[model samples]
Target: MVALRNLLTALFLPVKLCLFVFHHRVGRVRAARAAGDRGAISIELALAVIVLVGIAVAVLAVVMRLANTVKGKVPTDPVVTAAP
Candidate 1:
């Protein structure tokens, strides 16, 4: 029972330590955010907008390529009518 307890403690000690550090770091970030840290928010928003625009551009390129491929395979010449 003692050995099992020791093993469990060894496994969980690092996890607990990490959680403690993360909790404190998050608290400090929250405090800073509450203290009027607007620049980070703006930067994050800009990055998000840039990412969305990039995705839109990529999708547009793919659609254009598909349109061109389909257009190439289509028969564009006019059909002739038979004489009566």
Candidate 2:
């Protein structure tokens, strides 16, 4: 049994070494692809944020104009006078 075990170990050592090297190389490739994806996502996020901010500013400007118009049309005088 010990001899059989030794023989099997010797036979499989090369296959194990090949697998280890393949996994290490694949891991490096995956890490490089992930780095590129991160940069692209960051740029897209920045552009989206800028567009949202522009929309918010435009909405605020329109609201301010409408508020001013309403304020100008409203009368300051009371509608009903209080009894003395």
Candidate 3:
């Protein structure tokens, strides 16, 4: 169970870090908007899109890994039906 916990922690660490950075950037964007910084909003939005895409790719990779693991554990067999 220690290994599982470690694995889970490792897997989620990057996601958590990404979320924290994204949150910080959003806050910065909001502060800039409040200060009447027009171009900063566009730059912030572009940065946000890039971060979101990274997060999405990371999530997709994790999901695909999980799917492959599950598929490997499933049994493959042909069903045989008997008629009375």
**lDDT for each of the candidates?**
0.77, 0.74, 0.85
What lDDT is reached at residue 28 by model 2?
55
In the order shown, what is each candidate's alpha-carbon RMSD? Answer: 18.1, 26.8, 7.2
Q: What tens digits encode model 3's per-residue C-alpha lDDT throughout 47-76?
A: 778878998899899999999988886766
For 1-84, candidate 1 gives per-residue lDDT tens digits of 999999999989967965785576567567768998867756755675687679769979999999999898678756889999
Model 2: how far residue 34 lies from native, Å: 6.0
List, in order, the clash count of every candidate structure: 0, 0, 0
RMSD of 1: 18.1
Runs of candidate 1 with Cα error greater than 4 angstroms are 1-35, 76-84
Candidate 2: clashing pairs of residues: none
Pairs with steric clashes in candidate 1? none
TM-score of every model?
0.49, 0.47, 0.51
Model 1, 49: alpha-carbon shift in Å? 0.3
Q: Whose TM-score is greatest here?
A: 3
Model 2 is weakest, by summed lDDT over 10 consecutive residues, at 37-46
